[model samples]
Target: MGRLNTLDDWLNYQENLHFQDINLGLERVKKVYQRLFPKGVSFKVISVAGTNGKGSTVAFIGSIYQQSNFKVAQFSSPHILKYNERFVINSVQATDEQICHAFEKIESFRGETSLTYFEFSTLAALIIFELEKVDIAVLEVGLGGRLDSVNMVDNDVSVITNIDIDHVDYLGNTRELIGLEKAGIMRKNTPCICADTNPPASISQYAHQIKAQLEFVREKYASDIGLIGKHQQQNAATAMLAVQKLNKILPVNTIQIKAGIKYAQLDARFQIKTINNKTVILDVAHNAAAVKVLSAELAKQQCSTIAIFSALKDKNISLMINEISMIINQWLLVPLDVNRAINMKALSNEFNLNHNIHVCNDMQNAINRALNDKQYQRVVIFGSFHVVADALKILIPFMKNNEEEIL
Candidate 1:
């Protein structure tokens, strides 16, 4: 085990540390974490879990608390552009040196024990957050909450944003089963908020069984959050309500709440832009449920949409297509560069000539096809995070950096 001085070196080393891609248990990671950090620091921990809105809920919580003069450490997954984006402190992404130092420390402690990619990265985030002594840490669950590496931390406040059918192989196919998995984050007597109106019975049942104080986000805010769509309103209300419940731990005011709502925004979740004199909406909506939200959002604009889409094979593509079919005038589908990339022939067979769908081998060619024969006012790039991420390669280079909008 040689020294991993650079961030890239550490990343590459961790990528192959485990034989498999996803090792869904926490026993090995927990042993290594305990060995590394024997004495956990004092900081309020907020853990959020759900199928679709986990990231937004996390962004909302981080934004609101930071506005109230608290230094926040937020750990999220699946970095769109860079690995550094996964761990953020005080809204500033971790520098390569800082991440490398954390990774090196973890590696030193985890000599014999092998950790998965997500588990290693999560430990690094925890180490950096504790080393930096942030006031609060918000953790977004990487997968099923129970065995997910992040469940090792006892959350002061547990948030279950919404339960949907996702990760069926790992978390079960039914919503009730998935809800039980998400409810694993709840702690005894801790405040647990379920922002979903029709939450699964397993969530409430498990909360009751554990004697955790559970509450639905009863208050809905009518005011606009800096982001788009009505779905954001629910997430904002959940964040504000959660903060209010945490007054005993970290008190906040209405002024801070308003300011937080004014500034809270996350990239690739309904992010809109103008590229080549055309309105381009970039969304990481791979699931059918999220596609429904994307469709409803598209309804806000009367103009037809030309979409550049690609998704993993496991997703319910037929349902997703049906959900967004009304808004999309044409579909420019491309193959993703992932191990689980869907077979092109199987995907193409889902639609016929009347669907106005065109196939491309890669993202660049798909973009060229979309631009050459522009049939609509708006171009939507959705279906998966890979779609938006690949599109960013073309967008960020040619288009003037819109830090204010994109960031």
Candidate 2:
């Protein structure tokens, strides 16, 4: 293959290079990783694994470390806007030149191994982080913890952020079975934080068998987190408890924790934007668990909601729709271009009884309807992350109206 110059070229190469999209295992990636990085990482590693709150927990942890003057590198999956969003060095996304350089180096060493798009991108990010010699590396597990490429490095601190029933295909259907998979990232004698106060018994048994020190979330930090919604408070508490275990190495005061939780901003979580002078919220809540939290938050909103939504075919659509029906006054169902997206007719079956349900061919048309329509009090974009990513383009002209989220 010729040397790739643009970021698009690198992404296209990665997409085409893999035979399968999600090949879950460590040996193939670990073997190539070793060749790319002969000398292992010396920085403190914090690996976060969970069903819903993994991204928020990582954002909180990374922001706190950054505020405390520690050089931090974060590896998160599923970029919302751009591929560079997956790799953050010192709180900033890496430039195209930087990512291309990392890709070039990894390609030079990866001779025989065939890596998936995610695995290859993960290796490239790690190579950059190793070269930067960051003080702390915060890695968010892509899928199941045990076989995830991110789990190849032994983490100093491991956190499981309240596992639910998401990703049933790969991690098993039951919570107990899934908890065991998430617990695979825990190293022997290292501190393991279970953000879920009521995690399955298998997690406890596994941690005990591995001799990993485990801390269950309790009254340790019950105070409200900086973000809105009760679920966010729980996520903040989870990150707070996990950080306490690392206080000796990376000391941060209560003030910093307060600031860090307040400053921790993600792309789609309770993100508010004013589109054409009308307020709208963007939340990526596809699963039943996350939708439940979103519905609870919606109840607190002062006005009626008009939601522009799209969900993947694999999601539990019935539960999500039923949960939101309690608070949503109107629905603007849209279709996404992704392979997994569900069409409007398919989505109609779930909310068939609702009188106010409407449909549009695409996200932009839905946004257009939401902005022009006057019946609903506020517009909410929810369901899958892809819907919110596409909706951002429509809201770009009104970027100044976006509240709390950065550009």
lDDT by candidate, in order shown:
0.86, 0.84
Encode model 2's per-residue lDDT on 1-407: one tens digit a residue. 87788999988888889888888999899998777667777788999999988999999888777778778899998998888999998789988888999888878888878888898778877878888888889899999899999999889999999888987888899999999999999999999988886899989999999999988877534554555567777778778877778889988888888788877878788887665557778888879989898888878757867889889988888888888787888888888888788877888887767548888877778888888887776888989889889998777777855544423
Clashing pairs in 1: none
Clashing pairs in 2: none
Among all windows of 10 consecutive residues in model 2, the one with the lowest summed lDDT is: 398-407
TM-score for every candidate vs. truth?
0.96, 0.95
How does candidate 1 score on lDDT?
0.86
TM-score, cand. 2 vs. native: 0.95
